[model samples]
Target: MQFIINQISSFLKPDLTILALGADTRQRVSWTQSQKIYSLSPKKDLSDIRGFYFQAARFLKRAFRLSPDTITFDPHPNFVCKKEVDSIRGSYFPKASLAPIFHHIAHAANFGIE
Candidate 1:
């Protein structure tokens, strides 16, 4: 998975550092720096709401330290990961844009789909 992210990062050439919040199931936090991607392991499921927010807070702090230029979350509207990103956007990352990437599209990209 890490290798795949690395390859995508190289190909995309995102101009700004990015933070990606994974889906509700195996919640993950990934960030990029100089085309190198780093990701936190899958944590608790975000469907639990409270627990998901707590863990998300921690990961957000870690991601913030990297001063991400953009923040991405799963497109699932009900996903707690999306809520978490929205909450932080108001306070921690007011200038950063919130990008909601569709879940399946992300999966396909990771698998090397065009």
Candidate 2:
């Protein structure tokens, strides 16, 4: 995951804090600073949009000291995860940049594929 993040960092803004929204089944949030990840949420099944939103808000407010300069989400148009992320971005971090990654590429990279 670190290697993949390193590779992808080239396409992202430098010196910016990032919040990464994990895939749907094992939903989680990662707070990234200086290329390292600090998990803000435990891996769990997020069953509904309201639950996800509530947890995300709690994590963002309680876990991290700084607001994210950017947020990342899986690039699947119909994905509920993406919709949730979009809601967060719109409601809380409207000025932050969004970096949507290709779902298959992220999956392959997680397995150490180039």
Candidate 3:
């Protein structure tokens, strides 16, 4: 939880936050949002904390400047990530836009790879 607190301390008022939810072997919650240039993939399988993560994500959206229409997710239909993302989106940001992007693409984009 200390890490979360530290993260809060950092001045990251993101305009968008992408939830990297896929690649079954390692179900993580990552983000490569705009307007605050940073990426975060907590060192744990966040799929287990689906509820908590969304709650916090909602908070991030409300508390910080995170955009309301850019809650993204993976496009892989079979991954549990999609289901949870649907649930989170429905329960939290129902009107948010879908910005589907692959996990590999996000990672590769980090290093300027196309």
Q: Please, what is the whole-model Cα lDDT of each candidate in the order they appear?
A: 0.62, 0.61, 0.52
Better of 2 and 3 by lDDT: 2
lDDT of 1: 0.62
How high is the lDDT of residue 77 in model 2?
Answer: 71
Query: In angstroms, how far off is 99's CA in candidate 1?
Result: 1.1
* Cα-lDDT of candidate 2: 0.61
RMSD of each: 5.1, 6.0, 5.4
| Tens digit of per-residue lDDT, candidate 1, span 15-105 | 6687777666655556776766666643333346435444554555664466667888786768877667777666556777888898887
Backbone clashes in model 1, listed as residue pairs: none
lDDT of 3: 0.52
CA displacement after TM-score superposition, residue 62 of candidate 2 (Å): 3.4
